[model samples]
Target: MWEALVQPFAEFGFMRRALLGCIAISVGATPVGVFLLLRRMSLTGDAMAHAILPGAAVGYLVAGLSLGAMTIGGLLAGIAVALLSGFVTRVTALREDASLAAFYLISLALGVLIVSTRGSNVDLMHVLFGTVLALNNSALILLCSIASITLLALALLFRPLVLECADPQFLRAVSRLSAVTHFTFLALVVLNLVGGFHALGTLMVVGIMIVPAAAARFWAISIGGLILAAVTIAVAASVCGLLVSYHFGLPSGPAIILAAGLAYGLSLTFGPTGSFAARVHPYRHADA
Candidate 1:
């Protein structure tokens, strides 16, 4: 059993690289996801994912498939959209969510238009779906670097972030770091999404971020518990997804997301925290 599970990664360099890339992404993306879920900005993560597309597409237009070009393009586009949406929310009557929705829609359309017009169908597929099995050393380094940065940023932002999520008004009243914390968090979201796009593509990378965090909610109530559970779920899903992709000749990105979806399904049904089984058989309490 161990050999069956370990053989592909041991035998194939591509499989090993893919495994490492996915693990890095899982570690970096899951914590951001937990906070996004806590702040009820799950869909915001999705929006930011799509918002990076045009910049990546433009990068492809300018430099073919160069990793550095696409990474820079996607990062710029994502940060621009995030900052723009926040600015609109502050200056205008529109809410942040609504402003974000507007910008992301425009960004998605523009990106698709650019790719479809300037690139071939094959290029479109590569941009939209990613090629996980073909990761080079540079891509691996980028993923690892992003993961490291994310961990450090989260560590620094932990207390402010928790306060921001738990009591926004109180946090604002107590500290001027509220806005700084929010935008910094958004920048991290952009950074991780850009990194994830190299492996999972824009459409599916958000799945790695959001789904595991959502599933962890079924098992953990505290912020720390949720982060730990989400990371565990994400890493396990990455491993299973890679093995299934290797054995079944399936696309790696979708396989990973689907594996995460399965975890979510099980967590929903069987987890001890507000799951269906838990609801059906409530724990009895006695008066003291």
Candidate 2:
């Protein structure tokens, strides 16, 4: 059993690279996901993931399989959607969710159309599904670099961002950091998603970002605890999923997300805070 578990990673350089990339993504993106959950912006993260597709497709069209072009394209596209969604929400009667949904749907269609026009289904699958087991050194470096930048940016932005999440109006009234915090957070989301795009693909990347965060919600009470729990869950899922993919001949990306999904389901049923079992057998405080 130990050999079965340890041999693949020990023997295969690609497995090690995939593990490192998964850890990098989980460390950076999952915390951002926790914030998204706290701010009720989880769907916004999903929308932004889809929004990057067209840009990535354009990059593919121009520079076939070039990581730099795809990353740049995804970053540009995600930021554009975020800004446009914010603009529409501010300038019109439509809510942010409605605008985001509209934009992402259009973006998804455009991305698919572009890919279909110039490439085969295999190419489209590569864009949508990713190639985790085949991560080159460049992809690994990009993931690590993004992880470093994301953690640093989040550290600097932490207090203001917490303030913004807790009370937006108060944050706006008390300081000029409100819009700065908002846009900066959006940029981090885009940056992390772009990183995830290379490691996991546009479709599954948001799962890596969101699922662990969602599962951690039931386990953590404080923001710091939440971030820690989310990252831990993500790492565990990545390991399990990678092993399963190796043993069962499953797709690595979906296997990872499915592992996360399993964690989410277990959290829903058995976690400490808001889980089904918790509600059924509520913890009783001792009389003071």
Q: Write the per-residue lDDT of candidate 2 for residues 180-277, one digit (tens) a residue.
A: 99999999999999889887888999999999999999898899999999999999999999999999999999999999999999998989888888
lDDT of 1 by residue, 1-288 (tens): 888799999999999999999999999999999999999999999999999999999999999999999999999999999999989999999999999999999999999999999999988888888888989999999999999999999999999999999999999999999999999999999999999998998998999999999999999999999999999999999999999998898999999999999999999999888889878866722221
What's the lDDT for all of these models? 0.94, 0.94
- Between which residue pairs do clashes occur in model 1? none
True-structure lDDT of candidate 2: 0.94
Quote each prediction's TM-score: 0.97, 0.97
| TM-score quality measure for candidate 2 | 0.97
User: What TM-score does candidate 1 reach?
Assistant: 0.97
Model 2 sits at a Cα RMSD from the real structure of 1.5
Which runs in model 1 stand beyond 4 Å of their true positions?
284-288
